[model samples]
Structures are given as C-alpha cells and as structure tokens.
Target: MALGFEELDFQQTPMGELFLRRRVEPTLGADVYEVKLGDEYLMSSLFTEAEEQLAHLGLAPLDGSDLAVLVGGLGLGYTAVAALSHDAVGAMTVVDALPAVIDWHERGLLPVSAQLTGDPRTRLVLDDFFALMRRDPEARYDAILLDVDHSPRHSLDPSHADLYTPDGLRRLARHLREGGVFALWSDDPPDDDFMADLGTVFASTRAHVVEFANPLTGGTSTNTVYVAHSAG
Candidate 1:
C-alpha cells in the first residue's frame, strides 16, 4: 500500500489558520488524522486514549437515569463520542469556539463524524465556551467536560486563561445543576494551586493522571484530568 497524505480542509479563523489532514502511517500501520493550527499540531487520531479516559473518569461518579452533558471542545469528536457512549447520557451538547472544527465534522472530514453526528443524543453548537459559562443559560447540565486549552496556566489563546481563574470557575459551576460534575483535561500534570481554587468553588476536587504509551517516543507521558463536583 502507498502512504497517503491529504489535506481534508483549511480555514482562516480568528485564532489562526486551521487545517485538517489525514495521513496513512506506514510505520505505525494506521491511518492518522490530525488538526493543525498554523504549524502547531492541535490533535491527532493516533493518540486518543487520554481523551476518552477524560470522559469516562469524569462521568463515572454521576448516577442518574437521564443525564445532560456539556462538552467544552469537540476535537476530532473523541470526547463527545465518549460522552454519548454512556447509556445514561440522555442528551449531550458539544460546544467549540472554532467553527472550522465543527465544520470538519459536519463535512464528514473527521473519522468519527458519522457516529458522533448520527447519534440522536448529540448536538453540536459553535460558541465561545468560556463566554457561555459566564452567563446563565435556560438549562443546567449534569456534567461538564472541558478540553478547550492545553492547561490552566498554559493556553493556546491567551483569552482562554480566564476560564481557570477562581471567578471563572464559579461561573462554570453556576451553570451546572446541584451536585453536578466539572472535569478538565490537561496535557500537563496536576497543579496544586488550581486544585486549591477548585476547592473554593466545588465540594470535592481531584486530579486523575492518565498514562499511555507514546508510539514515537516508545515511552509514556501522562495527561491529567481535573474533576470538581458541585457543592450543592
């Protein structure tokens, strides 16, 4: 078989140039899909273990018959797909700041697009997640999964920095129903100061480290999933 490299789509957004590429990796013997902003790699289908784990660990504590979930980002549709996997999840709204990301899925350029969009429980919304959190919505959710930025301190766009602050976290908590759960995915290890701030806004807070094999490095790196349960 021949190694295939194709640029699926490209767009110029407020953030930067976003492009979706699908390549057949011969070394790994897999077809890899990736999203790039300028020259920086945003996400890839090659390594999605941590992304799926983020949803699993976050939704584990919720024991409800019909659950409503809000996912902050829809990178490659991994998180939204994982959230919809739960039988208890009656409805899920995935919101992303970048319209191009959402467009990729609707255009069927992404691998998981069909499964994610076909599911009746899923809804894709293009909006600024942080701004939406600051204001009160008509409804509250049972779980909120956030994977918009790299980490609390390090952000892809400087504007997202405010979401991790104490006041910003409180805004997020207000949008959740009583006893709701808030989860965040970070490429770095858990931060003590951030967790301390979570304690102020939430009743219970903890960080989960997800370790997976790195194909290129032949070693393991960890991703942290920070979880905070509502005080009510």
Candidate 2:
C-alpha cells in the first residue's frame, strides 16, 4: 500500500527550489504526482487534459508524416507523450531549463517517464527553451508546443516575457518551417490582446478553451491553448 504522501525529489536551482512529490488521493484512491517550484505548484498528474491538448491542437493543422516537433517545458512528460501519440510525429525534442526536472523523468520518478524516455523518437534536452528560440537554430521544426509560462500576461520568469511580444513571436516563427504550427498552453483565459499580437506573426491564430474535471474543486477547470499557423 502506498503512503499518504511522499517527497520524491528536491533540488535547488537558479529559479528556486523544485520539488517532486507523490500522494495518495483519497477521492480517487490513486497516487497523484505533483511538481512544485518554490511555493508555486507547477503541475500535477491529476489534470493533464490541457497539457495533452497543447499537442493535439498544435498538430491538428499540420499535415504529412514524419513530423519534427519541439516541446517546451517537459512537465510530467504529458505534452511530449501526447505529441508522440500522433503517427505523423517522427521526432520530438523536449527542452527544459532545469536539468533536475529532466533527471526526474530520466530516473523514471514520474508516471509518464517511461513513455517519454523509452521512445527513440523523443529527445530530452536540458536547455532554456526561451534561449534556444532566441538563438539562430540550425534546424526548424514542423511544430512547436510550449507550456512553460503561466500565461502571456504572467510569466514564471521575467526573461520569458519577451517571447510573448510580437517581435519575439516573429523570431520564434523564423524557426518554424513553412506553414508550421505553434501552440501554447496558458493558465489564463483567452486574452484578446495576445491574440492580436499573434496575428502579427502568424497567418492565423485561435485560442481553444480546454476544460477538465477538477477533483479537488469538484467542478471543472479550464486552460487555454493558443494555436498559430506560420505563413512560411
């Protein structure tokens, strides 16, 4: 029998203290894994619909097989795993700033670790996602799915703020193949302002409201997935 709660791992990083913990949920009678950075709860296995949708919505517009995908923020590996579910996805590169988070997945501490690490198509890279996008990359991807920041208006770090801007988005678009898709997961509701900014960089953009059951609240919670298509 599993205990009520257990702290799986902890690490001190430049951002803050990171923690991975597992607890037996009384309501679901199952083990729930969660990650926290400092006092902020990063992600939980309990609610992953939005995370999964980030990949689905992002790739829905893309066509053809052997797709190359890039995923930012490998939290719990849900987004990366979900992206791999598509047959068209030939290769997937997941980038994260914190190496400790990558270690947790490599160590199989998280539930979806096996699905992410076992697949030959998946490449887990320990790097700042934003920094990579800012640099002149040698390769471009068919799709880019990002789930790092809380929202365009709310960023985990100030350095991430620029990525939301029109110029920053344009730079990100440069890394995408023609007609490539860019999808983002945001905790905040749809923002008209951000949509306008995305309009400047991509050919088309839409915000999808993904609602999932909230076990703790006994109701539904919603997250936003913003999908944009590059003009080429």
Candidate 3:
C-alpha cells in the first residue's frame, strides 16, 4: 500500500525549483501525479484532455504515413503519448528545458512514462524548445505540438514570449515542412489577437476549445488548442 502522498523527485533548475509528486485523490481513490515549478502547478494527471487534444487536433490535418513530429513540452507525457497513438506518426522528438522532467519520464515515475520511453519511435531531448524554434533545425517536422507556456499572453519565462509573436512565429514556421501543422495548448481562452498573428504566418488557423472535467471543481473547465498549418 502506498502512502497518501510522496515526493518523487525535486531539482533546482535555472528556471526554478521543480517537483514531481504523487498523491492519492480521496475522491477519485486513485493515485495522481503532479509536477510543480516553484509554487505554480505545472501539470497534473487529473486533467489531461487538453494535453491529449493538442496532439490529436494537431495531427489530424496532416495526411501521410511515417510522419515526423516535434513536441515542445513533455509534461506527464500525455501529448507525446497521444501523438504516438496515431499510426501516421513515425517519429517523435520530445524536448524539455529541464532535465529533471525528462528524468521523471525515463525513470517511469509518471503513468504514461512507459508509453513514451518504451516506444522506439520516441526520442527524448533535453533542450529549450523555444530556442530550438528560434534557429533553423537540421530537419523539418510534419507537425509541431507545443504546450510549454500558459498562453501567448502569459509565459513561464519572458524569453518564451517571442515565440508567440508574428516574427517569432515566422521563425518557427520555417522549421516546418510545407503543409506542416503547428498546434499549441493554452490555458487561457482564445485570443483574437494571437489568432490574427497566426493567420499572418500560416495558410490557415483555428482555435479549439477543449473542455474537460475538473476534479477539483465540480464543473468543467476549458483550454485552447491553436492549430495552424503552413502553406502547402
């Protein structure tokens, strides 16, 4: 029998203190895993619908086998796992700024860890995803799924702000193959201004409102998934 709560791992990173914790939710009567950065909750197993949707909606537009995918955040491995569920996805690269986060998945601390780490198609990279987008990459991807920041208007670090801009988005678009899809998960509601910027860079853009049950709250909650496609 596991204890009610346990801290799986803790690390001091350049960003802040990162913590991985597991606790039994009395209501659900199931073990829940969570990640916190500093005092802010980064991810929780309790709510994963939006994270998984980021992959499904992102890859849906793409049509081709042996597709290469890039996932900007690896939190709880939900997005990556979801992306791999598609038979079209041939390879997936998951990038995270913090090594501790990757270690958690590698060590099988998270429930979806095995689904990510055990799959030969998955490659876990320790790198700043925003930085990777700023420069030209060695190769282009068929789809890029990002769930790093809170939103285009809010970010964990100021440096990440650029990626949301039109100019920054242009840089990111260059890394994608023609007709490639870019999908982002935002905690904030859809931003019209951000949608306009996305339109400027991509051939088309759409914001999806993903609703999921909130265990903490009795009612449902929503997150935005922005999907854009490069010019064909």
Better of 1 and 3 by TM-score: 3
Q: List candidate 1 segments past 4 Å from native.
A: none
lDDT of 2 by residue, 195-223 (tens): 99999999999999999999999999999
Q: lDDT per residue, candidate 1, 105-138, as tens digits?
A: 8988777899999999989998999889878876
Better-scoring candidate (lDDT), 1 or 3: 3
lDDT of 3: 0.93
Best-fitting candidate, scored by lDDT? 2
What local lDDT score does residue 159 receive in model 3, on the 0 to 100 scale?
95
Against the unseen true structure, what C-alpha lDDT does each candidate score?
0.88, 0.94, 0.93
TM-score, cand. 2 vs. native: 0.98
| Model 2 pairs whose backbones collide | none
Candidate 3 Cα RMSD after full superposition onto the native fold (Å): 0.8
Q: What TM-score does prediction 3 earn?
A: 0.98
Give the total clashing residue pairs for model 2: 0
